[model samples]
Target chain A: MLLTATLSLLLMQQAPSENVDWDAEFGVEEVERDPATGEIPVEPYEQNNENAGAKPFTGDDMAETFGGRDGIRQIAERFVEINFADPRIQGIFAGHDEVRLRRTIFEQFCYILNAGCDYTGRDMKSSHEGLGSRKADLNAIVENLQQAMREQDVPFAAQNRFLSKLAPMSRDVINR
Target chain B: MTPVFNHFATCLMVAPLALLPMSLCAQEVLSDTQSIDQAGTFPEYNAKLLLTNAVSAVDGASGGGISNWATIAGRQETRGVGVQAHVTAVLLPDFFYQSHGVALGIADRIELSYARQNFDTQDVGAALGIGQGYMLNQDVFGAKVRLFGDVVYGNTMVPQVAVGAQYKRSLDGAVASAVGAAHDEGVDVTLSATKLLLSHSVLVNTTARLTKANQNGLLGFGSVSDDSYAIQFEGAVAYQFSRRFVLGTEFRTKPDNLGLGEGDWFDVFAAYAPSDNLTVTAAYADLGSIATFTGQRGAFLQAQVAF
Candidate 1:
């Protein structure tokens, strides 16, 4: 009787291991941020400026109007900030790579505004895949971006000018 | 249902003899709301940007105060639906004009609208032997479909284009026949192109309308002498002062089919959106002469709500 009791206690102690996540145990890997770029590495594709989705302005006036590259960077950061905080669309963006978004968004803005930057990110279509975004979600993002631009003192007309460049991307960003 | 809505529906059901081929499927217009997600709450319906859906025109179509555009009413996007309702009044020196109606927008592709207009002849009614304070009522039912392009997106060089038709029925057949009208009902076909030049902060719309309407079908269709349709033009230019404020001017030509000397219409208007759901428009309108009363001008006021 004493031996049987001891064996049962030992079997119960080993039962907890049965619930272990076998997928992880089977060597599934979690993506890690690159030490150099501070962003999770992605499967690579050929990069092109056309991926920016818009042509840059011809003159430097538009760039200057946005307060140069630094201003563009700040605007991008604020835009992402508002997007992440906005409850209406946050669920769609919650799992996004914020570090990568800040840089790529800045690059897209800078390139489009003629502030001189190359976009190294994926195209709008691929980047927004599996996000389950709706038109209302897209509108929320636009509202947030507008708020960010307004905070950066972008003139309303200028803001709309910038918006016109981004508005066309909505078809790609929003789920059909 | 409100009496006004019941009346509007009644008018729609009773007027099946219109000149145009159309369907009666409209019951609402663009809704007023800034962002459906305001206050961090989930929205029941999609909400467009402030004033993006456009205000309710006097005719109940999606437009400014007096001119129709290529915009679809409702705060919904390409996959959602929306509705709006409006009440309007114009106090002319010699007459009083009132209109109310509803419109429905579907999937950003089609818009259906209905409006009832009442033109009180006031003292002019007595002079014309139609009894004092006689009112001329007209019911306008409209449908519009977007042919192609986007008003706020796509290639900036390509404006949004649409085709629409308004089937009008005059309720007072006796008064209309007495005025030498050939028919009590007519149709207006319109093609419109509209664009919002965000870079310039301007909105432009030009519409070509084919009609035989006398004072927008209040006095009825064409006259005994001529009952053919005439092509008229409607042009509007607006400046967006802010997200909620717009100032603009419009010009619309009218056909004097009855020889009532119903001249063209012009207005300088301002539209203000107080919230996502309410927009108020005030304008100085010059309707020219109506019937024989010359110098028909006045203040045009409209209030609209959409959801």
Candidate 2:
């Protein structure tokens, strides 16, 4: 009697719950019953591996997603246009000679493009000297540049690379 | 007894000299104290905003024109106590000068600064009638209080406003008083505001200052009452091109107090932060002249390190 009770407790622990209807849900076919005992065992389901695979991204795929450099240039041009409209900037470049001013703009773009060409324009001091430019004017220009970059969807990493090159000019640009 | 008395009197006379080294040592101790006091006054932001020293311009805000030259004033983030020392030198088109001094942050609310400016105008020749040339020297003592403002997190309603005053005095008493000028002493006051628009990635800083000083401690004499209370406006914008770098520009308009000239100032600049504690900045700047001078465009380089 003691042994039988111990076996019954062990079997109860290992048995499947009555709430689980495995045969009905999984559509398992009927199995032949043993002559001495009316019991059958069910097999585990097999997994399909044919469709579970990883693939590499190709160059053509990247082009299709980012739309390449041409798309980036268009975005840059729009940025310049919007930034030029700022009133503070309007005051700074207001009377500047068009030819020289255009050159300045072009040079900035060339540098951004990483074309490997010398800016060749006047150094920041010579360009702004005697102009009486102020901190407000500088802020406007920076805002416009940022706006332009944003419109182009330039990656944040690339934008920062450009900014790192530009930040040192502040000392020459203010309180002189 | 008579000789002994004489010896005692002599020792008494030498007592001051005997304590001279102790006094010097005391001064060194005072310097250290001043440094600690200055550091204690800055905002809690100093730990993360360590590069405020070298920039002099403090984010986008101007502390107080020539009177307030440090980037950030007071030591604490909001208010408590602190101290700072700054040295700046600029080589202009026609002149070169150096300015250096110390500032104390009190209650993390008010700040006091003293700076001496030494100017080398080179050769003025017969224009001033003094000699081949003469150098101009002056001292400026200034004070500022954070009336009602803050620049932390994303709060912008307060606008970080400050009011300040500066007193300038010249060393050349005769040259200064001879021109009907008031011994080269005057007071200047300003109201400043700074704000950051994080969504736009821009920082805008503005200042409106009133002054009666002449040549800003340059030129021969100080300001005449007739030209007192000149109004000046300055603004700057900085765009974070990346977490570690920013590009900015500035525009400032000044009063024509020198009777010598009139105009505005502007610049384009860029700043880089190699780490949270160090920042390097450069700019192309244009400063209208003291009087009839023009074409004073130039460049500047600055580095800031904070602890």
Candidate 3:
């Protein structure tokens, strides 16, 4: 009788259940890009134009200077690219979603420059949380952005006008 | 130190890079005690926007060409230390003036500075019977603490404020006493406020000083006729032309306690920063007169480095 009991326990251990989900049992969760935006999903948060962090320029002069929506898109793309490649600040951008960042930054700049776009990103404080940005890092980013804008032949004065709108946002962007 | 100025000439021919700290009203710490810029993934570095720290003044502190501002003398932000060195030459019709010094900044909060000033009387020395080529020398030691506010950040209405002290000691005590000076050494107390208006691309600074020095203490402190401290004013207004160029004017009032007709100092200066670490300033200074010699006006050139 003891031998029979031992044989049954061995059979139970060896049996494989075809209906079982091994991944669910192992606690592995998979994330997929949204088919509509081609960006990964983030936590749901309320979005508003205030999330852009500054009031948009009312006139079209700035928009035209930045080459309208097309020019701003190019600038945002180049800015992110430079940051990811820079040795000093690349670590902060590393592991973040490039596609999502490019889209959101473009939206923010477009909305601010009055190039006519809506910002759907989180507020600066929430977005920068845990990223650990410093004053030096902010300056580096500024220089890289300047380089990108220069490549687009943006006037230095116009760039400063745009920067004035964004300069105060440092209080929110830098993690104290 | 003038040799360093030579490097400035070739640098834009060569190379390329603070704010009045965005200090809060409640900030009292000598440094940023908290560990910021460390937990982040960003690499360590020192960088401030161009011309934001201002230039080293005649006294060797971070300021305009002739006026002291509420700025620390370094390129550091909130995390680390920085330093600056400067050499200034002022050529007047009757006198030759030069100053050189170095300053140390700690955590963008406190500043310590030392400068040596030499005033060459030239022909006027012979006229005054002090021997031709007579040089009046003094060492100026300065310490400043940022009381509150920021030059670059925060509300535009708020400005950076600082309190400082300068101790001036003349090396020629006997000559100074023989010339009717009450003392050969003195202290200057100063309170300064500065702000950068971004929208206007302008910077403004004002300082109130309590001092008893004659010709900034090179001619000695006070005179036998009037040995009392006087309230003086220093003011500067700068217009930013670009990230690298600044045009400004400064006026500094001095105590004429020596009663030799010392004139208030004035200068119209143009400063260019070829890179973050290098700034070259050239100005036309009108010193009015020194030691009864009239029309002391000419060129003032200074080269400064910060890191």
Candidate 4:
């Protein structure tokens, strides 16, 4: 029986299992497919990886530094749009109110930017208590937000300022 | 006595490499490398996660100030490259150790690092006839690559594993020879595993190193009595108190190959990161008998920057 158990353990160790390559699986290629010559594909998350770009914004007040309320609105809109479509994280948003989500996201961003906006959403830890969110899912959302800020032309430093405030929320949002 | 010199020597050798990461961070210009996605976001510091990227140790691999860790260097993943530099100083009662190092994280898969150590023998130098406050120096170049699993978020039982090597050379080879060492240069290889239980906010690392150096190459590589490489074990456990603060303890088992009476080493440490671009670490270490001195206890501090 001991020998049989040992053999079983060895076989279990060698068994094939799911191996998700988070990088390749969640890369930019899938969302930005090319047509015609198919050569001018959009730059993925890697090539444009500058958290603090040239002429980057520098200051403690991120909202005003990033074009004030208008910039936050644009970034929030784009972030919501992308999150709704991102396959990696879209499933978690099912049955939720899109309008409420958008408003919540905007208010949260404003609060982080210290724009004097009040966030009425539930506490992050409690809201995400049973979402079954994983690191991969959270990473996908952060990437989406990054893409949104990039599209809005927010300075890399500005983007980092906003993200830095948001980054800590991971503790509350993941697998609580 | 030899251990004091060894520690001091390794610290100086690591200094220059530590300067590179900060310079890289300061010199970065977005216009030169600006390739934004359709949504206009450029990828930066995309590999691993925040605070997950530890500072380069005295040995030039990512981890605490002294122990080597299993995480890759830098902040980049396969989509980008990351670089970090660090400087560490340990002030002991009998001697001092200073090290500078830089590490590169490639695609979150591999890590390459180099460090130099400088050891100041202080008054102990007079007894050894090397001169008071005599300094010894050595250089270490190292590389590590991830093998399997993920430390932060893997569903499987397999821990994140990495294997690396450090090539060490003593600049003061004459002093090493005088101390009855077999050689002044040697290579130390290590296999390390790390796992993080995110739910518990805990991280654990275990490393096995094959080395021939006495006092981490401060007394040179190998001894006249036993010149063969021996295996050593290192372990660390940390609890994440917040997004930016971690408290931990580390223990390293050493080989008693030389007459220096080298014993195990232990430390209690705290690491804090105010931002992704910077980190600071402080620790209290108990480095058992080195050479003739017993109870080499001291404070350790390290500052690191990465991009």
Off by over 4 Å in 4: A1-176, B1-47
lDDT (Cα, tens digit) per residue for candidate 2, span A52-125: 11121233432222234454345445555654565435545664444444444444544434442234455565
Residue A21 CA error for candidate 3 (Å)?
18
Please give the lDDT score at residue B83 for candidate 3. 88
TM-scores of the candidates, chain A only: 0.84, 0.50, 0.82, 0.63
After superposition, the stretches of candidate 3 with alpha carbons farther than 4 Å from their true spots are: A1-30, B1-45
In the range B1-307, model 2's lDDT, one tens digit per residue, is: 3333343344445547686433333333335556667656633433223223224432112242222322344333322344555555555686565566666666545667777777666554235555554677787787777765443222334455677777777776555555445546666676777654443556667777676555564543334545447687777777766656777888877665545574677777777868654556667767667445566666655554433
Candidate 1 residue-pair clash tally: 14
For candidate 1, give the DockQ. 0.24
In terms of DockQ, the best-performing candidate is 1
Which of the two, 1 or 2, has more DockQ?
1
From the highest DockQ down, the ranking of the candidates is 1, 3, 4, 2
Model 4, range B56-135, lDDT digits (tens) per residue?
Answer: 77788998666788898877655557899999899898999898989998877888899999999999899889999998
Q: Per model, how many backbone clashes are there?
A: 14, 67, 4, 34
lDDT of each model, Cα atoms only?
0.83, 0.52, 0.83, 0.73
What tens digits encode model 3's per-residue C-alpha lDDT throughout B2-33? 32234323332333201222122112111122
Name the lDDT of candidate 1: 0.83
In candidate 3, which residue pairs get closer than 3 Å at backbone N, Cα or C atoms, i.e. clash?
A: B11-B14, B17-B275, B17-B276, B17-B277
In CAPRI terms, where does candidate 1 land? acceptable
Worst 10 residues of 1 chain A by lDDT: A6-15
